[model samples]
Target chain A: MESNTVISIQNLVKRFPVGGDFFTALKNVDLKLHKGEFTGLIGPSGSGKTTLLNIIGGLDSASEGTVRVLDQSLDNTTHNERAKLRRKYMGFIFQSYNLLPVYTVFENIELPLILNKIDQANRIKRVNQAIEWVGLTNKRNSKPNMLSGGECQRTAIARALVHEPVLVMADEPTANLDAENSHNIMRILTKLNNELDTSFVFATHDEKIMGYLKRIIRLEDGNIINDKKIKKEDV
Target chain B: MLFKIALKNLLGAKLRTFLNVFVTAISFFMIIFMTGLYDGMRQHAKQVTIDTEIAGGAYWHPLYDPMEPILFEDSHSTLPQDIRSLVEKNKAVPILVSQAAIYPNGRIMPVIMKGIDPGQNIVNMPTNTLNNNKDINIPVLIGKGMANNAKLNVGDSFTIRWLDSDGTYDADEGTVVHIMDTENFKLDIGHIWIPIKKAQEMLAMKDEVTYVSYAIGEKKVKKSDGWIHRDVNYLIQDIEAAIEADKPSIQIMFTILLSLAAMGIFNAQVLSIFRRGKEIGTLMALGMTRAKVVGLFTLEGGINAILASALTVFPFGIILWWTAKHGVPMPMDYTEMGFMIAKRLMPIYSFGLIITTTILVFSIVIIVSYLPSRRIAKMKPTDALRGKTGI
Candidate 1:
């Protein structure tokens, strides 16, 4: 564990009771995420990268373990408390872009802020800034379907960051994009991490994405096979 | 924002939305139309009671009893002079009345020929009068129905024929001094009016009246006594009892028809809910609470019912106006009373019916959407994103 550790997971275990028997999804997973880090969670299908990310993000519960983020113990909170924690401290980007199709780019970005009950004047200021941050100010009023794959992904990222959460989670964020769009999304995520000191945890299998991250955690069969940090100077 | 999303989803599948709207509209229309018809009947019945002035729990006899014929002779069933004086002495009694009959053509075709006392009958027959010169000749006030049937106008002369005590018929011609609009026409089939005094002379029955009507004041009286003056409730009960005896089959058929119409509305709403399952699911998945999803569908149901009610009101209004203006004719005879009992019972449209049906349809929609919305709301985001389960 590093001195700047923003997230710490200890002996995290998740199991599903399927057909009168227990099926383990994550086996005693342990990991640490440091501040201002661009981290990649890499694994094959059923490797439990998504499961671990979900548990750490407070989107799902671990059957056994102590997971701590921003000094809040995930194991000690109620479901509503966990949801509130997710809303305030963590933001999520899905592979499908998950932008509510009925909303324009601006409204999608403003959703999390609205849920937090931020006033209209401040909400508009923050949302406009976010739209500009994602370089989509020109397309703020456009619906998700009107945007290309790369723009939609950027909109998702803008939504994640609009509330200024301490941690941002991306689950296979580039899976639906073309190679060019994928590279563009990675660049946007990397740049935001470097400039704003926001921590990003990405669950992905893209090899090209791995090169941009300072830390890479690889899982095999729900067990961490490799955990390594690359110095920014080396990159 | 969620509402906007819901509206968009509602509009997404144009054909399905149209189907829901159409079903709602038709159900609404049928419900409204049936209600209007009921109101019209009630209005018609009320008008018949008012126009005929059949007060004190009495309706005009449906047809003259064979044992008690209402003949032009005016000698039969006449109220004696002493009885009239006895009626007037009772302070609780408001009016004591008698009528006479005349047949213009000696035939049994339904007609009204009222012969009321100029002094005693002035309250009920407020418009009765002599010709302008105040002569003793009884002026005739004809109902529109009679005037139309006989093709006679004001000041027209017509012949009256009657059966004598010897079973031979006699005839006399008279002039129609007045023609009446339908609203004022109390006679149900066809009718004519004449002065009671003259009627007695023509029928050769001295100091005798055909029938008696009395308006009793509020003082309590013996319930089962054979007084002509009776309360409205008693009158209605008598009419209902008579109708039950005479037309039981018609009553049964009307009940069945009303039940079928109600069932049609119920079935239409049920089918609408079944068809909109996916649309409801989509609304719930878009972060709408289960209550809101149910509310939207309920609102849709209420909207349909209200629209239908509004649409039905106009046509029903026209029918009511027609009934009010033109009395409905009875097929049977009511010659002695000088008017047929028009079924002038108009329907009364009320806010309560609208509110009740709205709530009923809304509840149906809410109950129908409950389980479906809950199932959709509980689905995982991944499953929903994949459009699995088609919602």
Candidate 2:
């Protein structure tokens, strides 16, 4: 693996058990993600984009082949080790804004910092900064139930980035948002990617997200069909 | 981090958490209260027996058994020189017990005739009433129970018949001089007390007694001329044994109470884990180990115990304190059932009992909480994230 590569996957295959038989989810997936890259895996449902993202995020294991994320081989790592890796270096944003419903916006954003065992003083400062970055400073004390769809997604984004992780894997982050909220969310994520030099990998099929990605990998039927890089001026 | 989340979850649960805590607090209070009642009964019974009948101890003839009234005829003997000296000094009191019958209202009723020294004050009894009475021939002292049973009040006269030392029957006219209201039923029901001289003369048993009860603070008579020395513990063993025999029933009650509380917590935990699978997935996604998740839930249960203990202090504590101050009014007198329990039973709480019950309930709560949490370890994060986990 090169020094600039954040994730290196070679012939990665994932399968699930379905009634005494194997159902292939990802077929011989070969991919490499570099630092400071804005990438998206654009595919329809059942195309195995989420499965590949889960494998790279260390949430799932490959059935065969090796997956190296941030200079560590994820093929044989224990569950605790995977959790530690995710805690220290990775962030994840789900489509439905999976913020803990019991916690306020500020507390939800502060979760990753707390999990990382960051000092209280720093946690407060970082959580406030993340809230400001997401333009949710006024709604910091509001619980998830009280927030609008855009606000909830913003809180989830702030929570994902509070620790300034090297990699952020978002699975259809704007799926539940309107076109306006989708564009707004994509702009914030793009701004964060450029400012912090963080690598972003998203599994999405929304056309609104295509304009922000510097690289797009298309998949069909558990296999990658196209890989293309676009210039920033093309948008 | 675990404590904060657990506390937040409990607070979010609102009424569910309160219900579980309330049930646990109730269990805690009931166990302590019932145990205290039993302790109070045993202590009160022992103290009364020591003050009235047993005194410090007793030296009984070898064949004497209080439970066996049929053997009373063969359980009498003359006191030794040492015991006689103690009796002369008022440090001991001699008692003569014999199987006899009384003719009351033209009916033959079996009874135990006991002779006690009227002048000796070693035991708390109304024996002095039998001394120096010219109005009645044989002045007999009976208890309220015996009076009630015989339908004879004070100053009532009846015929007393007994067997002599030579196996000859004799009869005499006896008068109930004073009916004493005492708590010790052994000295009451179906027994009559007379002056020692009159008893000896009527029974032809010259200087013979059934047992010698020594005064409180008197040294144990090492040589009693082949008599058995019965201590206070031995004398009160029947009451203790009776209380012990009834413990299992109370234990069953405790188990039911504890199980009720434990089952409530267990059900709550199961529902919480099942409902919060998405939250669990998010936590694990943000990097919490399954063990920590399990600990978080278990700590939630522990906090339930803690909150229950707090509740026990507020409302339950006041109830317990009031009961300890003013006794619990029993529906009926227990003395009639041959138990030494008083009419108004007082509860006695001990430090050891409180600590033990607290630990026992807390431990059960934690265990039940953890039992449902072990499922978290088997849950797949992907399945949980999708809210697809079965249980």
Candidate 3:
């Protein structure tokens, strides 16, 4: 357990029961992520990238292995403890930009702070900062139904970062976005990661998205075939 | 904060919330109306009986049984002096009842002959009509119901034949002097009233009366030997038993109303659990526990009922207020049906009735709201996140 290691997975195995026999999603997968690392689980579909990402995000548990997030043992922690851990230290960005359809952009951004039970004054301040960071302050009153894909994804990013979590997990964040909006979203994530020193792990197979990552962990058929740090010159 | 979130959700699902709340509010208004109607009818009937028949209380002979009109010939005992003194002071009346046969327009019908003091003002009866200051034939008082049944009007003559104390049959011609409308069927159907002395002589039961009904003026009457002192409640016991007997029928009405309301809410909640899987998963992913999600949905459903209550209270209030102030005329004449109900009954609503109805409707709505939400607790956040659960 290094001081900088926020996520540590060892011999992690995840199996889903298909009919009667089990289908292995991840087999003895091992990974470690440090503070401020912009990493991507680069793999094709059914390659266990999302499965590993879910285990690291504390949304799912390893079937037969040890996993740690923010130095807390994931296998031993209760669901409530994991929820609290997610609330206090983790942020998530789904591929579909799962913004609450009824709430305004401002309200969606304020949701995480509300969940953390932060006082109104502090919540307003943080929400305003997050909204500005995503450049959606002008559209703060717009509900998700009226927002464009780019705006929705940006609002999703603001919601994820509003509480200033220690880690952010994104799953196919650019899947529904145009190439331009995809790059725009990637740039925002990169800026937030660099400026806030918050670690990020994105499960994306898009090469364009992978180009923005500082490290790429290529997974193939439930195994990590390649793990390497990208050089600034690689971009 | 939880309430605010729930309020927001309820407000968001406009149609679903509206239908459930409307149904719930319908149940609320119905229960209140029904109980109030029953209560109002009972209260009015009881008061009418007190005014016309049983004033405050009555003293009945131990052997007297009003239900068995045939036994009235043997049921009378001498009125107690305490009651006789009250009658002398115009605070009581000695009533003698006998069974007789009447022939009107060649139509022979059974009648329960009643005797009352023509001068008594203690009861609300129009017995003064029995005076018939200058009439030659025996004057009698009949209720509108009996007059209608017998086709007898004022000044119309009929023959009444009955057995005397010696078991001999006697016939007399009686002229109807007045026809009164009373709420009590006992005084209306097949009943005729004559002067107490005339009835006593006709029945050959001299110095004996069936019972002495008196107005004691809030003072309790002491039970005397050979007499049964019936209080106000005891006097209305038959009515209470009638209402009590109708309670299960009333309960069925409530059950149907509540069940329909519950079914509406249940349908909405089941749909919500299935349709809002992604939203629920998002909330769970945003650090809301499965319990909180259930609470939020349940609270939302409860708020639906409360909102419906708010929306309906004013409209229903006006309706109840109108019914209470004016009255609701019966669709059919209840008097002819042989039931004791006023022609136009003014509904009486009580604070307890409204509150109890609200509590019951809200309780049922909340319980209906929660059962479907329990399924939310079993959904896995990951599967719900993908909108793949509860399909």
Highest DockQ among the candidates is held by which one?
2
- Pick by TM-score: which candidate is best? 3
lDDT per residue for candidate 2 within B1-391, as digits (tens), equals 8897789878876887887788778878888888788777777777778888989889999999988988988998899888888899999999999989999888889999999999989889978999988877789999877888889988888999999888999899999999987778878888999998888888888899999999888887757788888888788788768668867966776677667756765676577667778888888899888898789878988999999999988899999999888989888755545666677778888898789789988998888778766686558788778876585
**Clashes found in each candidate (C-alpha, N, C closer than 3 A):** 24, 0, 0
| Of 1 and 2, the candidate ranking higher by DockQ | 2
Q: Estimate each model's TM-score.
A: 0.63, 0.84, 0.89
Candidate 3 stretches with Cα past 4 Å from truth are B11-20, B61-63, B74-82, B128-136, B144-157, B175-179, B197-209, B216-228, B244-256, B301-312, B346-348, B389-391
TM-score of chain B of 3: 0.87
Worst 10 residues of 3 chain B by lDDT: B216-225
Q: Could you tell me which 10 consecutive residues in candidate 1 chain B have the lowest summed lDDT?
A: B91-100
Q: Which has the better TM-score: candidate 2, or candidate 3? A: 3
Deviation of model 1 at A18, angstroms: 4.3
Give me the displacement of residue B132 in model 1, in angstroms: 19
Q: Give the clashing residue pairs of candidate 3, or none.
A: none
For all candidates in order, the CA lDDT equals 0.61, 0.88, 0.85
